[model samples]
Target: MTIQIRQFPCRRDNFGVIVHDDAGGPCVSIDAPEEGPIVAVLQREGWHLTHILTTHHHNDHTQANAALKARFGLEIIGPVRERERIPGLDRAVSGGDRIDLSGLEVEVIDTPGHTAGGISYYMPDEKLLFANDALFSLGCGRLFEGDAATMWASLQRLRSLPDDTMLYCGHEYTATNARFAIDVDPGNLLLQERVKEVEALRIEGKATVPVSLGREKRTNPFLRADDPGLAEAIGMAGADPVAVFAALRERRNGY
Candidate 1:
């Protein structure tokens, strides 16, 4: 059976997600951004909470891990590399490991750059990616602990996913990301169209997440960093893809 998903705003820009097969089946939260909203969604949906799939040790992503575990006694699973930092983490996983949620396996992929221990969960059966801070709609996380080459490799792995895959991220930064993307790839017609849509959505106070991987591949400057045209747009033509990616990430840092 396909998993059902519920996404709602947590503290500030953070978004909390819960997935399950049915109301009676075991439910899993992607990250515990906050305890109150996570509990609110579970209670409102009448879904039985059983586990939490933590993406990283970042406070915005794992701040409620301990509190949620105490409230629900749910299993806390996180990146093995950050075991010492994730509060209440019961299981540590790494790239290539598969975790079970409602009888379906969630493939864990190591995605560093935002943080050295960052990981992303991919539900191949559902074609859903909980990208965390590693990759966003049109932007990505800042280079806090990892270098450009490392983050670029992680991003390439994500880009290799099926074009139809739907992406879900932790924050609501798409509106701003779209703006930066247009500045860097102004000639991209698709980006132009998507930016209009993003602006309208933000004006109405809507979430611009859960975008298609195909859309991101074509329009997101970060994902397109390896494209010669994208590199040329930023005056980095013929530059190594890693160098192009580094320039884009650096520019976004100040955007």
Candidate 2:
């Protein structure tokens, strides 16, 4: 059975997502950016809220947790490290844990760069990843709580997933990310093409998410730290991959 995913914008730049299993067993909300939009989507799709899988303790992601829980009596799952922080957290999970959402098996991955206790969920059967703020299209989350090395390690873990994995992130920051990517990797023809595509999409007010892991490997600066060309472009030739990644991240901060 195929998993059905519904992604919609909510709360300025954040995205609200709903994932439903084909067997009609469980319909899960990836995050609750806001109460009204999420509730509206559930009503429109005729999907009953069964679970709320939170990636971190950030307010924008968990702001609607309490309201949704009261409205639908849904199970709230979040990182074990952030159990005390995330609102409405019913089940605390960590890396290597497997959550069974009815018939679906969701693998928990530790991704703690964006936050001290960030987590990502991956469904192997569907090749889908709910990365939250850990990874983004042609970009990555800011190193808010973790250091560059720590974030690099987290990103490497996500990069190890199959190239075909469909990554659904938490925001609509692709246009800005693409701009920074092009500035740093101007010689990359693939990046050039991707920037144009991103520009066109944003012009149409369309979402540029659920990007393929393969495309990110080729075009995302954070994921391309090991590439010799990227290292040279950033004047960090022969530097360690992590160091190159750190340099790019620092540059992006000011970009």
Candidate 3:
């Protein structure tokens, strides 16, 4: 079965993605940020909506859940930990739960950092990861609800995915993230080259998403907090990985 992915930008910086199984299976939206764009994509693609896989309960992510569910009668699935917060949530799932979207299988990964109940959807067949706000191209999400240790552990789960996995995040903050990355890891050749590429993409008004997990692991400082080189660069050599992660997050808050 061929899975079609349609990704579009909506709201201030949020992304809306739709995953479809073209072999007469289910078509699921990642997060319902708005009704209009999702409806537009459905109309353009001629695909029927079957479900909505929500990553978190943030308003920007779940605001349109009720409207879409009302229109299409979709099965809305979200994090069990925040089921009460998600609008129109039908099924509450946790990390180990596997969802069967027709013949396709979706792995639910708990990633509680940006929010206490944040989760990410990983499709092994497609090598697609709907990370939402947990992970980004050149950075990671801010600690809004969870603490440093929690967020750090959450990132490790994502980091364990295959290197070739394609990541789709919640926002278009790659440009800013690239700048911050360069400032923190000035001597990192991979990051330096990546910053140039990110600049060029932004210069032409293109989205810098769908970044590979391998590239992110090599450059994203938050994901690399345990690396001895990064630890020393930030004056935290030999520090615990969690401590290093905390310091990195603290600096990012100011950046």
Candidate 4:
């Protein structure tokens, strides 16, 4: 049995994802940006939603939680730190907690940067990560509720995963992220090549998500703060990795 993933556009730039396990078990919704799109997808696929895994309390991510719960009678799980803010939350989990989605084991990772209580779900058996807004393709989420250092730490934890892990983020901001990455890492051939690909994909009205962790490590500026070439390009050679990361993030905020 193979894990099946379905991704669709929602709202302005948000993405809605559904992950189905192969053993005929629970089907999980990564976020609830909107109800109509998700409900339509579920009906089309004949998949009964058994769980809703929320990354944070952000409205765009959890706005349809209550509706989905009411419609499907599914359990709502979210970050323990943000339990009060997550509507229809049935279970609250923090980092290092293992949640059993039917027979599948989903590891809850506390990723606090995009939001103070942001969480990510990693399915080690499938090498798939539902990162939501904490990390993005060629970019990391804005430091809305935490500092750069805090975000950097969260990224480090995700970076430690196997290079082959498939990262499914929350938005369709890859094109813009690629442009900013190239501006900061001009000397990186990998980054240059990737930007071209991203541009072509966006031109065709395609989604540029579920990117490999290996590709991100090589080209994403947010993930390459420790690289000597990137540090040098940013005129911060030999500086602490976290400081370099902070500088890159600050520059991106203005870009």
lDDT of 4 by residue, 1-255 (tens): 467899999999999999887679989999899999999998998889999999999999999998999999999999999999999999999999999987878999989998999999999998999998988988999999999889999998999999999999999999989989988888889888999999999989889988899999899888878888889999999998999999988888998
Off by over 4 Å in 4: none
Candidate 3: regions farther than 4 A off: none
Give the TM-scores of the predictions, in the order they appear.
Answer: 0.97, 0.98, 0.98, 0.98
Clashes of 4: 0
Model 2 Cα lDDT, one tens digit per residue, 118-181: 9999999999999989999999999999988889889999999999999999999899999999
Model 3, 142-192: lDDT tens digits are: 999999999999999999999999999999999998888888889999999
Model 2 regions more than 4 Å off: none
Q: Return the candidate ranking by lDDT, descending.
A: 3, 2, 4, 1
lDDT scores for all predictions? 0.90, 0.93, 0.93, 0.92
lDDT of 1 by residue, 147-215 (tens): 999999999989999999999999999988998999999999999999999999998988898999999
What C-alpha RMSD separates each model from the true structure? Answer: 1.0, 0.9, 0.8, 1.0
User: Best lDDT goes to which candidate?
Assistant: 3
Q: Can you give the lDDT of residue 89 in candidate 3?
A: 90
lDDT of 2 at 88: 86
Model 2, TM vs. native: 0.98
Better-scoring candidate (lDDT), 1 or 2? 2
